[model samples]
Target: MWLLETTTLKPQLFLGDSTPYYAILSHTWGSHDKLQNLAGYVKIIRCCAEAASCGFKYAWVDACCIDKTNSAELSERATECYVYLVDATDPSGFGNNRWFTRGWTLQELLAPCSVIFFDSDWNEIGTKASQAEFICHNYVAQRMSWATRRETAREEDLAYCLLGIFDISMPMVYGEGRKAFRQLQLEIMKESTDQSLFAFSYRLNIGIRPIVCHLLAESPSLFRECGTIQAPGDGPAPEYSTTNKGLRIELPLAHCIGGFYSAFLNLTRKVCNIREL
Candidate 1:
């Protein structure tokens, strides 16, 4: 008879946290004399502090959140977390911005999710551009699934799952982005050619930069001078339709689709100005 070691196996579990909101704050490495760029680090700290005031239950800051000595543990826990704050070095670095932003904010960054952005100005900028596009995609998909395919779908349950999914999915997305980029990187390395990751990243950068820029240029009014305003509801409710048109306004919310899309695009283009710069 072979002697067997007695050990208990633990089951993997995902009991969601009760915290209503979470945030991630990040900054590029700090070096003396790098004041201009280093300003981002200060802004990140302030942003995290502001988030806590906004009722975020938890906030992760790279300076204190991660244990650099323990890669194994970091890798494991990183898989499940909420929020990922990022700051890009420059405008041309949109590819880096997209990958890291998307990677750290995965489910919400792609497919479907709620997202927020801390702009270069320290104002959170996630309303009617890339962030909105990502959220709309998910919302539509969810509505589609519930209406036509699901038998036990519940709106409350969807809300619960949506928040948690945003948390855990980000790190996984980051890993995937790294892996995909690495494969392309290796191809360039092997060829020993003029091509590089930067070259391949150009097309992506061009497309994303304009979309975001134009969207912001058009919606400067939404952001305004105030950082954020508090509304008496779960959150700042998205008003998708409005029929207040000058001389005589009379309509229900149901009849506001035409104006909604028009306002959305017009404001987006004006605030963002992707076309000009």
Candidate 2:
């Protein structure tokens, strides 16, 4: 694990214990050469400066510090992450910041113990620790809804980046495409008995033919309308397990007209903005 020494007097490595407390940097990489750009170079310097001010002797900026060629480094964790909003100039413009739309940033935003936000010029904005009210209490479905608006370059990253957010880790087989998301849910099922995992449906506008989907959500985007769903009560769910054929479960579904059955997930919907817990 390589770390950037805060002092820019010269690029050098400082000896440290195996597990050193370090600050992480989260920012949007430009399509053009970010390493070659002057803004990008200054951003790294500013990050080290900010980290020094935070009393951290070491900092890890993903752009240049990470050795992408090494797969083992992908498993590393940080004490906190600093998010530099390159497109945001002030607090009011944050809602439209490009950082929020990035898929990789989703994990960066939720994974670390503390996340600090900074403006383009390195002005302090706020921290996510005190403001993250939803993560601790929100149900699986509702929490998954937060990533609907985010995107990744590779379709597989739509699920890969969410590894930390869900506290699940699996082998990263990039070319599998949408199967990665399903693999993520399967891994989540191992950690959680939350029945809301199955409470996903496609929300299409009128006149659009309903697209066929699997029992599990294909991507976080499918969890968009799931914002209103709530977790089930304390009642234990019927014994279930994942198999090659799919999830084998005993559900008490109600019979409906036209030979259809309705499976109430023991969930209630408020049908309004569910931003609050």
Candidate 3:
């Protein structure tokens, strides 16, 4: 493990079976370019100071601890790091903070068994364990909201950064564009039994929402009887497919007032007007 020296801000590597206590830093990088040099050390310093005050001898700041130049190392660290502190505070307060909207931060929020939120001034706010009920209740919806709006420098990272949250691993293919997200989702379906993974973007027909329902309905037979099932015997499995042949419905044209018809089609193709009141 490599840690940043709290005072000197230098890198220190440790190796052994004895686990040395360390604090991990989690914050949204406002600009990717800012993280390329020591000028971005402000967050690292604050995290180190906060960790030291908490009796932690070392800390891990993602911006500095991981060598972004090395893709394999970066992916490895992202997959392995599970304990972290989220810097959620802003001048406007936690609700308006960028940390909650960044693509990479999703895993930072979900994977950590122990997560502490800190204010802009490095003051303690709350812990994930304390907010378990609220998080669990809104997990799927909140995650969907996060994934939809979060930004990433590399488009593929929107899905790559979520690898930890879904407990899926894949080779990092940087330039795959939206296909990376599709691959990520397929991996999630293969490993997970959660149907909610398909419940995304119901409000936008052009997005992943429309395709996910078909994906879920056509998932391997293993997902048919229950939420989960064992892989079939060593032979060719059944194939699944779908098509967009379009839908039609009959309704009173008089009821389509105030442009409701236009908005309805934009939302979903499966739903159409019916004559029955």
Candidate 4:
């Protein structure tokens, strides 16, 4: 079903209360075209089911949730959107910065109230080398093809797939890939900072577009985290200090692949369009 009107989805705004949690509906591939699209929708419902099992009461997904038609409302609602969904993947020069949240879109970097645990054992899957196998075995993917076009795409995707898919062997696989991806990502950021023209392109490709995707992804995360989702406010914002940190930003390949597949399915709705495996 389509999302309700913007007015209908406009959640109540609060002062100090926390916003709902959201989950990313990444990954949407199938045996055929129709099945591929159906997979995207399935991820949304699956997120809800998994979240509910983890004490979460709500979730926000873009496909059947947000009313993108209302530009005014969407933009307005976007500012305080940081309450959930901090996309670790941005083409921005800050891709490697563990402190990248500071540059998050108005839609990300907000407070979270709930969390969804998929109990995904991607690390144990035998087909960890292939993204499709990762999804088929555990069902996850958050990256889009557009983002994967960069130089670090392969290594990053490899790390993500291996990190979340393999249970025992993930450490070695993830370490090797992470090291390589980090090196390449650092080079890109350095080039952008040193050169003038390169900096401009970097902002357009990595900074802006990734921020948009992140904002959209946060919706579902907010719903899943918080008991009730709502609009954000300028009250007490979340704190992020470089000196004080924990897990750095890292979006697994499953997440990226899932997002790509879902987006593709959404773009092409050819009835059960079957293609090669």
Top-lDDT candidate index: 2
lDDT per residue, candidate 2, 147-230, as tens digits? 888878899988877787787878889799999999899898888767778888776563433344578888888888778777
Q: Which model is ahead, 2 or 3, in terms of lDDT?
A: 2
Model 2: number of clashes?
0
Q: Write the per-residue lDDT of candidate 4 for residues 1-277, one digit (tens) a residue.
A: 1221222333333222254433332222234524247545445555555445445445454555545453322222211111121222333322232222121121122222221112122111211122232222111111111122222224434333222122212122333644643333233333222111011111234522233332112111211212111113433322212113431222223234325321211011112221111
Who is ahead in lDDT, 1 or 3? 3
Better of 2 and 3 by TM-score: 2
TM-score of 3: 0.60
How would you encode candidate 1's per-residue C-alpha lDDT over 69-143 as one tens digit per residue?
533323222211223234544545443443242222333333222334554555554422453422221221122
Query: Model 2 clash pairs?
Result: none
lDDT per model, in order? 0.30, 0.76, 0.53, 0.27
Model 3 accuracy (lDDT, Cα): 0.53
Error of 4 at 265 (Å): 44
Order of the predicted models by TM-score, top scorer first: 2, 3, 1, 4
Candidate 4 TM-score over all chains jointly: 0.25
Off by over 4 Å in 1: 1-21, 26-41, 71-113, 127-277
Instruction: Please give each candidate's TM-score.
Output: 0.30, 0.86, 0.60, 0.25
For model 1, state the Cα shift of residue 141 in Å. Answer: 18
Write down the worst ten-residue block by lDDT for model 2: 8-17
Worst 10 residues of 4 by lDDT: 193-202
